[model samples]
Target: MNKDFNSIVKVWEAAVRKSAGPKKRANRIFSTPMSVAHVDDDVYQVEKILNNGDFYTGQWLNNFPNGHGKYLWTDGCMYVGEWQKGNITGKGRFSWPSGATYEGDFKNGFMDGKGTYIGSNGDTYKGFWVMDMKNGQGTQSYPNGDFYDGDWKKGLQNGHGRYQWKNGNHYIGQFRNGLFNGNGTLMWQNGNRYDGCWEDGFPKGNGTFRWCDGSFYVGVWSKDSKEQSGTYYPSSGSDDDPLEWDPMDLFSVDLIDCYVCGCEKVSIFPSQKNLNMFGLEEDNNNKHLLSKKVTER
Candidate 1:
């Protein structure tokens, strides 16, 4: 074995002896391949044994907690797996003194990884973690039967995801700092659906909102209110009308004007009696009518 390994083993042996006490010496001899160093400091396994005989185990390097290990405090809190200089690191499991249990990645003794935590109240969280909190993608279930599945950050629902309440209310979309922000869609149990941008949990920005009663609005939204907008056109006939119309029909009026104006004026009237016949009418009606008329020589 390497010198370092041998030295670590010796230290581990001494720690075991110290913790086990003289009475338990004859029970068994504990062994490990870990070493201790008193140069920069003392490397030793630290343990706290309760009066009831429950034991907590961990490591101390250079008189401080270091490396990968665990500690079960006398208070009933138990931490197992991974350590760095006495701080939790890497993947591990932790059971709170209150009966809650967490299993996942760890960093500096905090939960950080792809893991799960079951709360004492029966709620549960399963997903990515950061510093003992839920962050990134995951799922959370409430004890009261509510649940959320979506992106998370620093233990809050942030970014995009879906929230389903026990009352059958649901919101799916962008979130910020746990509140509805950006764009989202809300579906209420009453059969109404609101699709639009949100700010501070209120509808804000442009969108199309529809109610279960066949009413809807498509326009700019401002803080849950509809501004100037267009009709919803709820019926299927309104939806299909535009598609049924021929594309060429839009130019029909213009086509008629162009054709008629290009034709000869005489051909348009077709009767000389109708043309300049106005002159003869003025002559017959007396010069008073003629005085009102300008001679078009």
Candidate 2:
């Protein structure tokens, strides 16, 4: 951080705040900087340094950085791109000392419009931004092979989007505050799928689960599908009419983490009726659905 620059900014801000009335408050967090640089009479292309050891080299107007210019800060941050009226604006590339880089549209020093950000941890996001935050459509790729393609708001995963975990588990649904909080479909790599509503990163509300072996269940669920409550229909014959009209009490089977930071695995136990109907030997994957008792992974 540049202390000199910050002090100057603070002094300038104080002046603005005292000017504005109480009703019209000036957000100190967001600032509109005003400064004048002192240069020689010959104000041609030249390199000028500020009091804070920040330097700008390129087209300058009236002692301020204007038009195309490159600015380098004392903290090892450098920006090379367009400048307007002493502010970092327009298209440019900003690089930080932490190995993070942003290349795209900028507005008054804030990342706004289309751009791509490469984080220090190798995470990359390409999308639209508003006031330095990720907004609108974008695609984010994680170093661990996790990927997200969807809508974003205030730098969080919001609205509709698709998240693909590194374990081959993918979810497509609506999100709120970076979690699976709305309707979506989670498809496990093992061919297990759940289509329903989600809340706070877990499965909740009414939904349908389809197993790989043709078994399925329809019911309301809460949190993860640990012990789900609903009706289970084992895959005996047709999808329409179940060969056995028996409803088994579904209990703890698998723990599908929907696992943001962890992994999800769900297993269904064979009901006594399913065992008798299809015979355990014949139907290897014979399990059914409903009532849930969520447990930690």
Candidate 3:
């Protein structure tokens, strides 16, 4: 009983109007004649009684629209769906005057469960909803040919998903509050690829940058820029010595030499050829000397 009945009515009225069409057109209520007949205890049927000479003939309970009903509001707003104690519930389809439409499951007068919402601006979202907000897995497509398909929480991309732009740039990975965060992979239309950890939509921490020319860099990054020195591997090396490889390169290996250690032959142990490849001569088990520039290419 602490809930304000007047406020609740106003909110419900607003929800209907907003979902129908332009807010300015629905600001005022239109008068109409209506009749009500009692069916049983606290149950009745209303006819010809709605805003703006609209029609509503349906079952009512507790003096409110309940059970199955059809309500055509003023300003061409129409809703045909199930109701529970005056609130839209279950399956329904609501159409606005501007050609916007929503068809899906509802609960407590709010869009919940699976549904599709097509906006007048040519944007569309088809996914799980909660309280009229995108809340779960869904796909949103923009008018500009860009689209996002992934997990959502409270209308924001808050989990793993993929977004592709019209220009051919795309990102796939974890997200937090609609921004790229944690691990992800981004690919440019020009054939550049970045695989690494991200923070605030920029590549950060350890990552790899593979250029279109076959040269690649593996190392730490700060705000998407290479920090300090990193290991560079040329696609075509003429050096007779074995090339140095990053530990992460083995992650994409399809075969491994050892079952117990899961280490591939190229990464498990470095040979004397490997030491000479990096211009390094081992001084001890943990250190070495740089004999020359290993990456002259």
Candidate 4:
């Protein structure tokens, strides 16, 4: 966002220089006609048509545009708003050739305060701007049915925000550089939710996953969310009873006895054959949805 808006500023600066151009560069820029040229100390303001085909019709003070004005560039870019000295300031609307527009408050020629930016691609951003970048709080909506509402920094998602995927998945958490970081909650539409810490976009460290069917796992998840070393308590056994695990395993308990399925230690991999054992095949391959599709299960 910063790089693209700067191009418009460059052209505007050049045009301002041409307003007072010298004869040394007469080929591209010619002298302003006396009728509309800057008249120093004159209280009256009039429209000016420069030789380069640019147009400015507004209030001028001394020799610079200062107050309300309309500036039209030959390249099809246009600005209609307030002006201070020679810079675009106060309230205004800047439109690009592609139909993209920015309407808001400006200070020192940069988009500041609050504004709304509508892109040519149907993306709309309404929020706080600093130096032409989306900063502070804002809401960015896409044409793809996805939406993000929360904190923004330097045109990217930073701090905390809520992102809703077009596919019915949503995450509420802290973010750094657009990826999930710190503590957060990711809830799948299928009724499975994970509350934990995430690094980058993957879940990591200690967390808990609760399935739609009421089965749950509490343990430390690998960075990839592929495997979890914890206790899997069956829905029927809400008490202290847990499915028997390998005695040598670190998560094993000393005297906990298995009673239900006679199921011994369960070693879960991402294969459908292993996941179908407990009717978890509907959410297979997702890995993280259940660990990554067992810990990638």
Best by lDDT: 2
TM-scores for every predicted model: 0.56, 0.66, 0.63, 0.66
Candidate 4 on 1-297: residue-level lDDT in tens?
A: 234534765666456544532222122222333223334555334454546555566666654567787776555556788887657779998876566788998876677889988777777889998877789999887767677888888777889999876777788989877777889888777787778887776657777777678877777766333455666666654665665322123212210221001111112111111110001111334321110111211
Question: Candidate 2's residue-wise lDDT over 1-297, tens digit each?
Answer: 243864654454344334422221111111112122334563334444543334555665553456677665444456788877656779898866555888999887777999998877787899999987789999988878889999999888999999998888898989998888889998888898888878887667888878888888888776444555677787867556643322222212333435543211111100100110000011224321111221211
For candidate 3, write residues 162-220 as lDDT tens digits: 98877777888998877778998877777767788877666578888776777777877
Please give the lDDT score at residue 74 for candidate 3: 43
Stretches of candidate 3 above 4 Å error?
A: 1-45, 51-55, 224-229, 237-297
TM-score of 3: 0.63
Q: Who is ahead in lDDT, 1 or 3? A: 3
Q: Model 1: how far is 74 from its true place, Å? A: 3.4
lDDT of 4 at 147: 79
Better of 2 and 3 by lDDT: 2
Model 1: ten consecutive residues of lowest lDDT = 260-269
Collision count for each candidate, in order: 11, 13, 0, 15
Ten-residue stretch with the least lDDT total in model 3: 267-276
Rank ordering of all candidates by lDDT, starting from the highest: 2, 3, 4, 1
lDDT of 3 at 182: 95
Residue 37, candidate 4: Cα error in Å is 12
